[model samples]
Target: MGICDAPARAKVLNMSQHNGSFGCNYCKIYAPFNEDLKCRVFVPTSNLQPRTTDEWKKLALAASNTKITRANEREFLGVKGWNQLLRLPYIDIVSFCPPDYMHSQLLGTVRLLLAYWLGGRSQLFKYNFHMVWHLPQVVRQYGPLITNSAFQLENWMGKIAKQIHESKIHIAEQAINKCSVISSTITNFYSNIDCFETEFIKYF
Candidate 1:
């Protein structure tokens, strides 16, 4: 599962960013930026439908086939082009890749919601608040928390960085070797965990 920020997710999926008209990954709604409120607001419609993996692939493929300078513009949908990740049959490009909760919620959604409640734009606050309610639907569809988070990824990255003793030379090789060693250590520990538990019980 690819857990990243909205912008990073967009880059990975080869789609438009969050601020774009068709930016929402889950909803196929055209959210235009309201200059007065300074944010993209979704217009509620009876026929609003959730984005499906099959639909996404078709749109993405069509966008890529356009072969224009601005292919994303050519396509009404926000899809830019085909991504290498699409080759994996198991990974549903729509559902598998979820934005990290911390960045998408705490720093993004919650922050904006708070701003609305704090009385910046009193007249349009209610309308904007209702528009932002699509988040709950997203959570229900994708789940509240993903398998991975930014913190966990950052920690792993730090460990990998520390494993490299040299500055620039053979860094990739060193990282791979270090990761292999770590993986083996973890495997061995897990393989012998039952034996260790039995020994502990016998001795104690």
Candidate 2:
């Protein structure tokens, strides 16, 4: 599943744990599975029964008392919620959520670039620059380079936005016209390949 780290790992799993604690949702060595563990939002897979608010609060209280050692803190934090989710038959939660390159890489990079050009030594610029500096290390933890990036999607959408602005057409009609223009252009380009070759040969 694609999700940000703080919400998925920290708030969900390590509730009440010190913010600086190095905890996570996945490692068995750190947070071993226990049947006795409680969760505020427990959902039984078989019956799909929902726990009462009071029961959830009790679970949360119990979970808060569960001792987490510094060494295995990360694994222990989110066991309750993680285990509960695992019992559900339909949803197969992956061990790790893929880092969002769209937000963290492409848009992040653009933000950094903008900060460099426009921020003019402001604190916001400094913060963005710092993040940009650490981006490579952050990406390395996730996996290989992203094959597709937000840059392409954002750029295409930006062009569409510009077209909409220039055309001053109704939004719905602009969308239809844009698609029609693109399809017609592609068809015409392919159909005129022989003509293009003839012109190329004559020009040469």
Task: List residue ranges in candidate 1 displaced over 4 A.
Answer: 44-47, 67-75, 116-146, 165-168, 180-204
**lDDT by residue (tens digit), candidate 2, 85-186:** 434455433323333456644555466566667955322222122234334544444333342223434445566666575455778788777886556554
- lDDT of every predicted structure (CA atoms): 0.65, 0.40
User: Candidate 1's residue-wise lDDT over 109-204, tens digit each?
Assistant: 566667668966443322223334454554555443432336545555666677888666687788677888667554654445445455545754
Cα deviation of 167 in candidate 2 (Å)?
7.0
> Which candidate should be chosen as best, given lDDT against the real structure?
1
How many clashing pairs per prediction, in order? 0, 4
Q: Which residue pairs show backbone clashes in model 1? A: none
For each candidate, C-alpha RMSD in Å?
8.0, 16.1
Taking all chains together, the TM-score of candidate 1 against the true structure is: 0.68
